[model samples]
Target: MTGKLYGVSVGPGDPELITLKGLKAIQSADVVAFPAGKNGKPGMAESIAQTYLQPHQEKLPLELPYVQDPDALTTAWAVATDQLYEHLSRDRRVVFISEGDVSFYSTFTYLMLTLRARDTAIEIQTIPGVCSPLAAAAELGLPLTIWAEKLAVLPLLHNLAELETALDWAETVVLMKVNRYYPQVWQILRSRQLLQNSSVVVRATSNQQKIYADLTNLADLSLSYFSVLIVRRSQQWFNSS
Candidate 1:
C-alpha cells in the first residue's frame, strides 16, 4: 500500500503562522521533506516547521535550486520526485513543507507536478497558509484590497513596461522578487508620484522582518530575495492613516 503525500504551507516565515492542520501533518508524518537550504543552513520552510517536528520522523532535504533555466529545474524536480517516491512506495506517509502558500509561486508546486507525472495513482493533499502579500499587509496595518479595487500580483519583473501596465489598470499592485529590481521599481513609482503610497516589506512576519512604509527615500535601499513591494494607486489609502 502506497502512502499519501501532503503539501503543507508553513506560512510567510513566522512559525506561529502555520495552520493547525499543517502542523499536525508535519508532526504525524513518517517523513518530512523540504527544499534543501543553501550554505549548509536550514531552509525557511524547515525552520518554520521545525518546532512541530517529531524526533522519530525522517527528514528529507531535497535540493530544489533557485534557477531560471528550464532544463536545470526539470532535472532537479525529477530527482526530488524520485526521492519522495522512494518513501511513499514503502508506505511511509510523506509531508513536503513549503514556505508561504503552497499554491502561490511555491516550489512545492513543481515537485508535486513532477511527482504526479511519475505516478498518476499517487494521492496528494495541499494545505494553504498565509502568503507574503497578506502577511506584509497585516504588518503594515493596511488592507490588500477594499471595495471593488482590482489587485495585481506579479513575480520578478522582466521589464519595467509590466509595472507600467499594472499601474495602469490595477488599484493595488504587489511586486514579488523585488530584490534586484528595487531601483527600477522605485523610479517607476516616483515618476508616477506614487512613492508615498508604496511600501516594502522584507522577510515579512519573521523575527528579522523589516517594513518600509514609505518609499520616498528608499531608492538606494538594498533588499533581500524575500522582499515584497506593495503599491496603492489611490493616495487616499495612505493619507487616511
Candidate 2:
C-alpha cells in the first residue's frame, strides 16, 4: 500500500487558527516537511505546526531559495520532490505544512505539481486554513467585500501598471508580498488619491502583528516581508488628514 501526501495549511501567523483537519494531519503524519527559505532557517509553517508534531516523527527541511530565477526554482522543486520520493516509495505517510492556504501562492502547489507529473497516480490531500488577506482584514476591521463588490487578491506587484488596474477594476484589492515594492505602491496610491482608503498589515493575528492605517507614515515605515496592503478603492474608512 503506497502512502499518501497531505498538504496542510497552518493559517496566517496564529497557530490556533489552524483547522482541526489540518491539525489531525500534522499529528498523524509520519514525515513532516516544510520549505526552508534562502537563509536555511526553519519555515514559518513548521513553527506554527511544531506543537502538533510527534516527538518521533521525521522532519524534512526542503531548501527553497528566495530567488526569481525560474531555472533555480524548478531545480529546487525537483530536488525536493526527489527527497519525498524516497519516503513515499517506502509507504511512509508524509505531510507538508504551508503557512497559508495551500492553494493560494504556496510552495506546496509546486511540490504537488511536480510529484503528480512524476507519477499521476500519487495520492494527495489538501487542508485549507485562514489566509493572510482574511486575517489582515479582520485585524483592521475592514470588510473585504460588501454585497456585490469585487475583490482581487494579487500575490505580488512587480510594477505599477497592474496595481493601477487592480485599483480601477476592483472595489477591494489585497496585495500580498508588498514589502519590497511598498514605496512604489504607496506613490501610485497617493498619486491616484487612494491613500486614505488603504491600509498595511504586518504579521496579522500574530504576537508581532502591526497595523498601519495611516498611509502618510508608510513612507518612513520599514515593513516586514510578511506585510500586506489592502486598498478599498471607494471606501474612506481609514481616512488620514
Q: Estimate each model's TM-score.
A: 0.97, 0.94
| Most accurate candidate by lDDT | 1
Worst 10 residues of 2 by lDDT: 232-241
Candidate 1 Cα deviation (angstroms), residue 45: 0.5
Could you tell me the TM-score of candidate 2? 0.94
Candidate 1 segments whose C-alpha is farther than 4 A from its true place: 237-241
lDDT of each: 0.92, 0.87
Q: Give the least accurate 10-residue stretch of model 1, judged by summed lDDT.
A: 232-241
Model 2 Cα lDDT, one tens digit per residue, 1-241: 3888999999988899999999988988899999874455567888788778888999998987777999999999999999987788789999999997888899899999999999888889999989999999899888888768899888877667998888888999999989888888888888988888889999888888999986965676788899989988866444531
| Reference-based TM-score, model 1 | 0.97
Q: Cα miss at 63, model 2 (Å)?
A: 0.6
Clashing pairs in 1: none
